[model samples]
Target: MTNAEHISEIATLDNVVSPDKVRLLQLLQTQKAAFLAEPYPSYRSRIDDLKRLKAAILASKETLLSALEKDFHYRSHDESLLGDIFSSLSSIDYATKHLRQWMKPQKRHVGVVFQPAKAEVLYQPRGVVGIISPWNYPVFLTIGPLVAAIAAGNRAMIKVSEFTPHTNTVLRHLLGEVFSQDKVCVVHGETDVAQAFSSLPFDHLLFTGSTQVGRHVMKAASENLVSVTLELGGKSPVIIDNNISLDAAVSRFIYGKTMNAGQTCVAPDYIYCPKNRVDELVDAIKTRYLAMYPSIDGCNKRTRVINHRQYTRLQGYLEEASNLGANVIPLGDVASDETSCFMPLTLITGADQSMAVMREEIFGPILPIVAYDNIEQVIASINENSRPLGLYIQSHDKAFQNKVLRETHAGGVCINDAAFHVVVDDLPFGGIGESGMGSYHGVEGFRTFSHAKSLFKRGRICFSDMLFPPYGKKIHDLFYRFFIR
Candidate 1:
């Protein structure tokens, strides 16, 4: 091949790879090269990155809040501060605090047969991690995994949700302030760019979104055999055991469901309460929720549904449930304002598995309550569906809580509460089965973006030469006879 045709020939190029794909490929190559140049970032360097991340988040706090409001229609500033800003800052602090310990090689026990050799695991950085963050908690989801990637000494490229154009711009600015494009790149476009981005060969890809789209992302990543940590959403259930007070249980789990107006992945999708106490539960929920969200007040501090499409989706859930004979209870003075896209926390009773509300993941402020006769029914009913990202058990009875914990499966469990598990730094936030595949929060987050490479080193003396002969000797026979057992 001469210099003229060294790069490629027009006829030789794959037509399937579009210009958008070409740009993504080039970006991947650039990041991969940068990663190769500094494959393993040192402790000091990673700390510097974390520190810079913290500072940049603080510096861009106002802009981030404004961007979130613009994108979310009317996202609460406090919600953004807690979920997006503070959560990311907390993750950076956690990674910074624990990175030194996490980076240190872990020692492993050596068997008696291999006494002269030492075994350990080195946390190796898998180059060029790709993060596809959702619009719900854009900044946190993007920066959370990025903290892990940086802590693990890996380069990254983030593809934010297209629904969040304003927030995306702010994110690009926030990240740009901290690192160069090669070290940390931010890309955004419609679904086509997202598809092309996922199809790229990455060391690892972390995506936080709906379960349906999660499947597509996983399949696209599989094309390159890329590892993925999908933080997919599903129907997370909240159980109200007889031991706890009705009002108390509502207070704990209702906060989780209504915080992002039930737009949270781990929000309590439905409640499982005693059949006899269903009315009491409803009363408790109404009283508790109305206190927090009195009225629409024209969408002030009220988190509207992200857009009209989601607003209509939530409305459809209510309509279908009502048509199926489920009692739809709208709580606030103004239950919903379509123009504002603000839908108050509504409750559904007599819901069954057949309804779409129960079938799909309701990412809006709709809550469904299912009455059960006993704990067994609740556990059995929950098992019938796919595993969720989070599970909430409200009970003071130790045995009751233990039984629910052992009987059911979820990515994370919140005792007497909900959605708080995912926000914690130490806990591993992920899904099981249909909900999602992998987790990333703190140490788990660090490990998710890292390659745990096992290393074995020999001492001055050699242990293998004794057994490396053409024929088996008496020593080998004795060693095998003794060690085999």
Candidate 2:
């Protein structure tokens, strides 16, 4: 699989798209109506749906891995299995095990004055949910949100990115095998279809993509008053503390930067290394990267850019940085055709705010290492920018790590590691500000796709009559004084 092969395949899919938006409308309507019919699914039914989804994913494992490779030219089989397939299965497993407790009504604390009344919150399904998945990890993004929606007992309609048509086909087939169109449906097309899908009146919408496009998705969703959970990307920064081992830091850094060829939303976009340790850190990173993949020329471990358009965008970033006097260092000396899109993992020095690589999210295998004298500068630099989806710190100093963690504001933070915070099902995953808003994963995910309805039950005998309106009695005066404070 190569860039040209992906383009030719996308051309074939382009012919299969509907001539208009009729199918998109039809699918949404069907899902919405089905949701209305089964407004609140039983815990058993939700688990069953999740089970079916898990089974479908396992059944289509090979197809999914192959499609991902075709879509990305050379996506690693291990990456697909761990990132896409395994994550999806784990979500289903977690949901199935905890849904019973999640669906149970939780009791709430009441004031002593309201002893005669009882209160609890009931988790209710939010009806239909719409998910717009990006091309980078098509299956994981789509299925991840779908898992949350299913756990909350809602029907879902997914819109996968156009660049990953092969993976989209497999997803549609696999999901369709488990769920009817009304229960869970996958929509496929280019920009128009995506816009139409986003504009649909879903109960909730979850979009995972770039910050710029996230604005459009949020705007479109707002038209219908649809609550959205945007899992967006930004220039997530990594800090190498002056006290940590360079080898350990660079090893973890290399994993985060090279995974999916740095196409991840939470991938370490840039690194802040000690001013004196820049060369040593860069050398360690290069050594670790090459030791893993000696040659990126035809390595399966090196995932290619999704398409030529993306490849060109990455190349343009490098070219612009080079023109702006950035020191570009390619990690591998792979003698290969540029058309293959196997972008060598490179490090950029002298990268500043003026350069495009530093300002925007570099969704490629390019890591811009900035030299910093102190941790305060790193904290200040992070705060000055829009909040990122993730922040990484390589430090063993408990006090320093705590200080950095307390000072910085990112959707998630990793200590002594990079980009692994998202895999922790116990923690909520999302972003803030330009990175995006709202969170979904674990309990937060269930709540994201659900409506926590507050319930109150009053006893037969109460003090309501004593506090009736039409009098200024001493008791009323006492009550007012007691409550007004």
Question: lDDT of each model, Cα atoms only?
Answer: 0.89, 0.86
List where candidate 1 sits over 4 angstroms from the true fold. 1-14, 296-298
Q: Candidate 1, residues 1-485: lDDT per residue as tens digits?
A: 52124213422365677777778777777788788788999999999989998998899999999999999888999999998898999999889889999999999999877778899999999989999999899899889999999999999999999998999999898889899999999999999999888887789999899889999999988966889999898999999987689988998888899887889899999989899999999999989977887765545878879999999989999999999999999987775878889888899999998999999999889999999999999999889989988899999999999998999999999998889988789988899999999898889988999999999999798767778876588888898788788
Each candidate: RMSD: 2.6, 6.8
lDDT of 2 by residue, 216-332 (tens): 989988976889999999999888888889999887767887889899999999999999999999889888988888874345566887778888888888889999999989877
Leading candidate by TM-score: 1
Angstrom error of the Cα, residue 407, model 2: value is 1.7
Model 1 global lDDT (CA atoms, 0 to 1): 0.89
